[model samples]
Target: MTQTVPTPAHLVRQRYRDPQPTEPAQWNEVLRVLHEHRSVRRYLADPVSDDTLRLLISAAQSAPTSSNLQVWSVVAVRDPRRKARLAALAGDQAHILQAPVLLVWTADFARLRQLADDHDAPLEGADYLESSYVGFIDAALAAQNAVVAAESLGLGTVYLGALRNHPENVAAELNLPAQVFAVFGLLVGHPDPAEDARVKPRLPQGAVLHHETYDLAVQRAHVAEYETRIAEFYAEQQLAHSWTERVLNRLGSVASLNGRHRLRASLENHGFRLK
Candidate 1:
């Protein structure tokens, strides 16, 4: 028997769990890949070749930089021992070990600093909080590009934000310089078929897409609609969760930050003088 394929309409509906998703006026392979994204927690032990990795990095470099500063860098880890060590520091997620490559994306300023020192130029702007944000934003944009590239190539990926749990330790493990900070880790490899991961639902566009001024009152109703639609997805995944409760619990207290509350100090230690 031939397997049935999902149409663009189905994929869009799946993306939002919308009872009636807007049919795209234009559709293509890129749209399909984007709408079908699923973060794979389980991966097969297939090695991602250096050639493929290089292509992904080139795609990442194509991402827009802030004023052409290009303040981001990445460290690719393939050694099982190093990956295991990073996995330990990053919530001990099993996918990091199972995946063939762990890309450590970093907000880097060391290169610029070296250039400034060599030319005896004053780099006072790099000491500001705005500059730190620029570096972090640059790293995130680049990493997202690489994610899209990997997914288009039929590989799987999951972003590990918990890498911030022990920022100092992660920097040490990666041998990152003082002026560089690990923003996050990305696991990339062949997805295990047994996992059967599906595209998770997101909030209704009404809640997020503002027309002009924001409407806080309308957001509650949209959240309610999201809760209702996503509940079905949660049930299908056998997950006992409520979006409201999860959001509240995740930010209820300092403890919920999981050591991330000390992020300012961690950034300073890494030479980011967020003045």
Candidate 2:
């Protein structure tokens, strides 16, 4: 049986649901994988082997780190019981328990802190808010690299931002040391074909990609266009909410944060002096 190859234009059209889609100037395997990404929540019982996990981490480490500080680490959780506990802490997302592995990515300053303590040196810069941003950014970059690598390998993955809902609990559950903050969780496994997940449409390129100065006023028109395009995507998934309404509901109130409003205090408790 001949497999139908998706051209760059097809993928781009699927991504933005653009009415008049244009073919990409260039295309490659990496671009194809990136454009076809979809979060897989349902998974088979198949286990992700240790060898595969190591490969994913190697890909993650290949990502560019801020100043090469590489202030990131990942904890691979495969134990069913531990995953269950973490699922409980993270809004009880069943996917956490269903997936064979849950990789808890962390912004790690503890390694550098330990090095400084051994050398009897003061690391005052790490106390600054800039350093915190660096750590978070580095972790995100590394995790994205891992995601790309995982998708390229035909494995399914989904990010679990809800891991931050109870930061202290997650830290304790993972036995994390001071200065090592859990950035987020990534569930990796073989996707259940029964789930039938599809590529989620995104905002138009004009809405985000700016050449020079950012134009705030033009965003309204772009977003209006996006609403129409993304409505078809929502309808296919049987979703009733509009994109604007969904985002508004997500951030319109303090209650929408789901206890993340105390993140500052949680960071302080975890020894992150966000100065």
Candidate 3:
């Protein structure tokens, strides 16, 4: 007997757990991979090969960069002791230690700065807040490309945003130079089947996909609808808190920033003038 394949409509339904989902106009392998994405926190002992890592980097490089400045770099860390220390700095996330490889993505400007200095050229623009944003955006785009490539290759991955919680320590551990800020870390490895991670549902299309003009007032209703829909997902994950509560707790106060409240100061200390 031939195995049945899932249609685009089915995948859409699965993505939102929507009571009524319309069939998409088109579908392909890329869409399937994107729709199936999930954060795999539990990983196996198996190593990610060098060949695969190179391919992932190449894929990342293929992502478009602003003015092709390519202001991003990635450090692949595999040392157990180093990973443990970095993990400790990043909220004690066990997955950092569990994964065989941790890729630290950085917004790098030191490379260009060195070139400018060598040529005796003024690099004043690098000190601006807009330039800093460009670097961060470039790093994010590159890392996301790598994430998609890793998932396509059957490797499990999870992004460690908490790496920024203690940016200075992470910078020291990675030996990052001034003007090279660690944006985040990504853990890549073989997933543990026991974990059985599921694809997280997202907000309804009406909540985000706006038309010619934005509508702020209708967002409350959409959020209310989303809360109801996502409640099922929360129950399945054994989580008691609602999405609103979780988000609020994350951003309710300065203390909730997990030391990131001083991010501006940290950036300044790291050579980002943010002018």
Candidate 4:
């Protein structure tokens, strides 16, 4: 039996779960990979080799940096013991231990600080709140590229934002130095086909793709529409949840942040002046 492979545009349209998907104006392997992204929660026990990890990092490094500072670093943790400990620290996400690799991406400024110290230079700029944004942005761009590359090679992945819940513990577990904060943990491994996680729906184009100026008045309407769409997705998984309710609960109170509400104090403790 022969199987037909989907084109890049088809994959892109599939991502949105678009009811009336249009043909893409452009197509490439990169687009194909980007569109096929789905956060896989279950994984096979297969290992991801060091050579492949190196390739993923190469792809990450190829991403553009803010002012070429490249204030980012990644720790590829394959040790099951270490991964299990990290998983425990990060909300006990089972996938972290199940996956062969947990790539801990960080917003690293320790290297630059050392360089400045060596040159007897004042690195006052790094203390500003803006610089923290730059580091976070740089790390995100790099991680996303790695995600795309992994998907292209038929790997599955999921982002563990819960790593921030107990930042201090995570930093200690990873042996991170001052000024190097774990942004997130990425679980990378072969997919468990039984999970069959489909592409999650997204807000419609009209909700985000503004013509020129931003419009806030119509946002409520768009969000309302998105709730209906995502509800169907949740129903298919036999889960009962509301998008609005979930979003509200996620951010309605500081207590819900799961220790992340103390991030400012945590950051200060870690040497990020964030002035």
lDDT of 3 at 95: 92
Per-model TM-score versus the true fold: 0.98, 0.98, 0.97, 0.96
lDDT of 2 by residue, 1-275 (tens): 99999889999999999878899999999999999999999999988988999999999999999999999999999999999999998999999999999999999999999999999999999998999999999999999999999999999999999999999999999999999999999999999999999999898888898887988888899999999988998899999999999999999999999888988888889989998
Point out where model 1 deviates above 4 Å: none
* Per-structure clash totals for the candidates: 0, 0, 0, 0
C-alpha lDDT (0 to 100) for residue 268 of candidate 2: 88
lDDT (CA) for every model shown?
0.94, 0.94, 0.93, 0.89
Candidate 3: stretches off by over 4 Å = 1-5
TM-score, prediction 1: 0.98
What C-alpha lDDT, on a 0 to 100 scale, does residue 268 get in candidate 3? 92
What is candidate 4's local distance difference test score?
0.89
lDDT tens string, model 3, 199-254? 88898888898999999888898899889988998999999999999999999999
Error of 1 at 235 (Å): 0.9
lDDT of 2: 0.94
lDDT of 1 by residue, 160-227 (tens): 99999999999999899998999998999999999999999999889999997988899999999999
Model 4: residues >4 Å from true position, as ranges?
7-12
C-alpha RMSD values across all candidates: 0.9, 0.9, 1.3, 1.4
**Ten contiguous residues with the weakest lDDT in model 3:** 3-12
